[model samples]
Target chain A: MLERLSDKWVTLVLTGLASGPRRYSDLSRRIAGVSQKMLTQTLRGLERDGLVRRTVTPSVPVRVDYELTPLGESLMPLVAAIKGWAEANIQTVEAARKTYDAA
Target chain B: MLERLSDKWVTLVLTGLASGPRRYSDLSRRIAGVSQKMLTQTLRGLERDGLVRRTVTPSVPVRVDYELTPLGESLMPLVAAIKGWAEANIQTVEAARKTYDAA
Candidate 1:
């Protein structure tokens, strides 16, 4: 569970869906650098975990959208906090790594 | 950064040190399933990230203790929340997975 939550792609995919439902292409574009296989796997994991819902719309071309389940939504504040901490402290962490490596 | 923060070993190690400094042996014992190599790696990663401090005491066996830095302490509430959420919702998640798999 921790592994799944901490996964980089999982973080990205959850964040992408936080605002609203998104098509796979939208997520693939928003999360830059995520491979198709990884995105699919992450979505599947999230769906299985009951944190995400996958909706399929039948049209000329089938449309699949992913959105957060209530459980997933409840987790957003925590996820956002983690993301905020990472963004704010990444520089400090990088400097620490450099200093540690030099020692 | 999210990956590091979300890591299962990282969570366990940080939680183990949440109260105060602990010896490697103590942490190894506290975090039941963690291997020695993984514990060492997690501690090193935390140290490098500036979230943990390692003190070496010159003793017969060179006593080593690990404690959270201010930054690490700051992260505890978040980690605690995640831990709480996981414990509370794990059964629900398991049920969801079982249902998903059966369908």
Candidate 2:
């Protein structure tokens, strides 16, 4: 849904997983500000939406990894473009905000 | 910021203003599900973020119009892409959700 995709965590999670499969701990570490609960919820939401795939190994300790599905991968270009635009225009936005606030 | 752009109301508001300037009432009407309060908040946020421009006219009822700034207009392509992806993939996402929930 447009609403869900608009969520910041969802964008970050999707972009983060774009690189490759990552364990829970790795994801938490890589995405600096996300809490464990938030990460878990986001992954579940993405999985339910079919944008993320979760894999669990049958090893002694049992390891879990998360990666993007083909559908999710397809979303990357748009996401990346948005991210690039945001970074490039942040200063302009900030200046506008200050001017608006002053007036 | 990327986080702000990901807000659904922000996206709708930006896209709504994409066509041309719109009055507060017109925007509320055009964007079907948005409440007056939410619309005001979203627009203020967008204005603060430098994406939407708010103009006040000293006419009979003192009309206020909203339009996208150059920076905001620049984001239109990315937003359009995301909306297109969502519309195209909704069924896929829904089917995936049902499958995930059932299992």
Candidate 3:
């Protein structure tokens, strides 16, 4: 499970779901640039790990919604902290990159 | 940089560095289960990205030390928060796991 969440797409998917339950297509739309295959694979992995719940309802064309489980919801604060940390230190990291490249 | 930090070993290495500067061998030891190849690779990646500093002292047996750069140290609080969040909600996750398994 720990190993599973370490992927870039997984983190992005989780961040997208942090907003609310999203259908498969909506998730693919919300996270720009992820391939359909990758999005589906990541979502299944999250579901298998018990981090996400997938609900399928009979509709005109089968409506499906994916939402954070308790386990997944519990991870939100940590994700937010990490995102906040990244935003806070991006300046220093960029400056360091410039310095490193100059060196 | 964000893409790079999303790896499991990167997170583990950053957590290990959160303690203090450590030699390559010490980091391998401190992390308590990372493969030598993975550790070296992850450290090299961090160094390349300027998130970590590598210091070498010339001697009969040359000593090399690695530590968090300012940007790396900046991630400590976030790492701590994530780890702390995981620790705090472990029970909830576990319970969720049981419920999930039973279902």
Model 3 Cα interface RMS deviation (Å): 3.8
Which tens-of-lDDT digit does each residue in A1-103 have in candidate 2? 6566558898889988998999999999989899999999999999998999999999989999999999999988887887788789879988998998898
* Candidate 1 structure quality by residue, lDDT tens digits, A31-53: 98999999999999999999999
**Which pairs, if any, clash in model 1?**
none
- Candidate 1 segments whose C-alpha is farther than 4 A from its true place: B33-35, B59-61
RMSD in order of candidates? 2.3, 2.6, 3.8
lDDT of 2 by residue, B1-103 (tens): 6666567888889888999999999999999999999999999988888888889999998999999989889989988888788889889999999999999
Comparing to the true complex, what docking class would candidate 1 get?
A: medium
In candidate 3, how many Å is residue A5 off?
A: 3.9
Off by over 4 Å in 2: A3-8, A33-35, B1-6
List the global CA lDDT of all models.
Answer: 0.88, 0.88, 0.80
Return the clash pairs for model 3, or none. none
For TM-score, the strongest prediction is: 1
Q: In terms of docking quality, how is candidate 3 classified?
A: acceptable
Residues B1-103, candidate 3, lDDT per residue (tens digit)? 7655546688889988888899988888878779999899888778877789999999769999999988788777766665676677667666766776677
> Order of candidates by DockQ, top first?
1, 2, 3
Candidate 1 chain B: 10-residue stretch with minimal lDDT: B1-10
